[model samples]
Target: MIRLYTKNAVLLAVVAAASYELAAEFGPWPALLTCAAAAAAASAAGAFLLRTSGVGRVTWRNRLAGYLIPWGWRLNRGKLWPIPVVSWAVWTAVCGAAVLLRPAPDQPALGTRAALLAAWVIDAAALVYLLGTLARATPGGRVGPIWKLVAVIAGVISASVGLYVGGQTTAALVVGGGPPVVVGGGFGLLLLFVVTVGRNTRWN
Candidate 1:
């Protein structure tokens, strides 16, 4: 649909802007390389997540088929609620924390900080639209054992990395690297698991 394409386009634009801002901290060549790597990583990750989550696979398949045949692609809005909700929530929290807690001397310009905040707002809007689409697609669904296992494994790895990083940078942990890692890797994964898997539900 036009709306789906519009929302996706907006999200992509924001992501590109953010990527440029982040990568531009380095020189021109490094920025170009970073952007290229980020694009590739994002595409691969998106495909993997879509396949693993069992959502949006049909859309991609249809698009691929359209490329080979004469018929236009039928875009079925998939159950993409969790993807934007989880990813944007984690990204906003982690990035916001990093920006706020960055050392005073190394803080980004006010304009850059403002732009980042604006991007988060746009992401929030996109998330709302995706959730609405998902709700219309399906009333509800249960998380399966495989996803729960995946969540647990991801959570454990995140917590372990957070602890290790926190230990290594004890002095700057509170001010610099610590908060983002804790908020992102520690609390983010916990929140994600709880929301997706539920608190009282049995893992098995």
Candidate 2:
């Protein structure tokens, strides 16, 4: 669909911009290389999991298709919207805290900070829009209440710890603490997505 592509384009643009800004701290080449390696590693891990899960070939193909071709996946719009919106908000909050708490001399100019905040807001909005659209195309289903509650609690705890660490020691927050929270949030989202979409999926 034109609308889906447009939304994805917007989301990707925002992500690219955010990544570019983040990469400024490290050189672009190193950042690009790191991202490439991470992507490859993730792909390999995903492939290994799929291969070892004892699923039929068709089921494995469907799962791989869902991941590789997200637009084709049947997603419940109502359930999908909130996930990205909330995830992006939490990520932004954590990164925002780091920006705010940076040493005075290392702090970005006011204009830069404002621009970053604006970009983050746009990124979140775009992600919600895109995922929400996908959700609308697919039939809806109920995710277990337990999973929802767990996600909420995990998000809150991660945000609290990230904020506290950022305030106490920005170095530790950036170098050690921040990554785990982000990674945890990512895995949580992935699990939530699997639970929500996988349940209603009909494998060939």
lDDT, candidates in the order shown:
0.44, 0.46
Question: Residue 95 of candidate 1: its Cα lDDT?
Answer: 39
Tell me the deviation in Å of residue 70 in model 1. 20
- Candidate 2 accuracy as TM-score: 0.27
Off by over 4 Å in 1: 55-204
TM value for model 1: 0.26
Give per-residue CA lDDT, model 1, range 1-204, as digits (tens): 797567544554565456545544644445555555554454445545555543435666444322222111111244433443344443343333333322234454655444444433443333344444444443355435434544543444345335424443233233333334455688788888899887778879
- Cα lDDT for residue 103, candidate 2: 33
Best by lDDT: 2
> Tens-digit lDDT track for model 2 on 113-172?
444334333333334444444446435545355345445545544454454345433332
RMSD of each: 15.2, 15.7
